[model samples]
Target: AAAPAAPARASGEEIKSPMVGTIYLQANPTSPAFVKVGDMVEVGQTMFIVEAMKTMNPIPATRAGKIVEILVEDAQPVEFGEPLAIIE
Candidate 1:
């Protein structure tokens, strides 16, 4: 008999950056940010966008939760696996 298929895994909390680039807060100067502290977020929602190699990528939320803190600031450079924001 054929083997049974593996069950699907559960989704967990995480921060996902769309691309490898500098992180910008607002679209431009004198503009508000895409996200902020104590903001409620939904799964698959765009928290921010990262620009890498002249390409803009939207960063989405992995799980639904409220933003507890922001680790990075506007116009700050971030690396992979960097904690951009804390969700709870």
Candidate 2:
């Protein structure tokens, strides 16, 4: 069977996962998310944390832009190359 297609956005650059793991949108449960929709981000800004094998890897933004959409929820499991958010 074919995998379901990911939701398509009107326009934006996608920030994809570099590893398969659980994605964290915030530093901790009580903290604000690293980035949210409509937030402007700069190159190299920490966008999300991918926890793999008990290690937390900070994922950085490769391009500077305003966050248009967040594709995954906090603590959600993500696959390698999975789209995490969209920046425009």
Candidate 3:
């Protein structure tokens, strides 16, 4: 199957995975997602976590902005520089 097209980036910023890992959209499975499309996020705010080498690492927004789209699914394996979410 063909890969999904690149998501539109309004501000041209994305929260990328720092290491190869599995992405978690919430603190826990039952908890609400850390963010959703259209939610406003601040700099240093915890957006999501990546489990690498059995460690959960929080990913933060480098700048404050509204979330335009979520590019990753919960528990999905992600690579370094992969777009996790689009913020603008």
Model 2: worst 10 consecutive residues (lDDT sum): 5-14
Candidate 2 lDDT over residue span 1-88, tens digit each: 9999866684888899999999999999999999988999999999999999999999999999999999999999999999899999
lDDT of 3 by residue, 1-88 (tens): 9999865566658788889999999999899999999999999999999999999999998889999889899999999999898888
User: Can you give the lDDT of residue 67 in candidate 1?
Assistant: 83
Off by over 4 Å in 2: 1-7
Off by over 4 Å in 3: 1-11
Worst 10 residues of 1 by lDDT: 7-16
Top model by lDDT, which number? 2
* Model 1 bad stretches (over 4 Å): 1-18
TM-score winner between 1 and 3, please give it: 3
lDDT scores in order: 0.75, 0.95, 0.90
User: Could you give candidate 1's per-residue lDDT for residues 8-29 as a string of tens digits?
Assistant: 4223344745456888776767
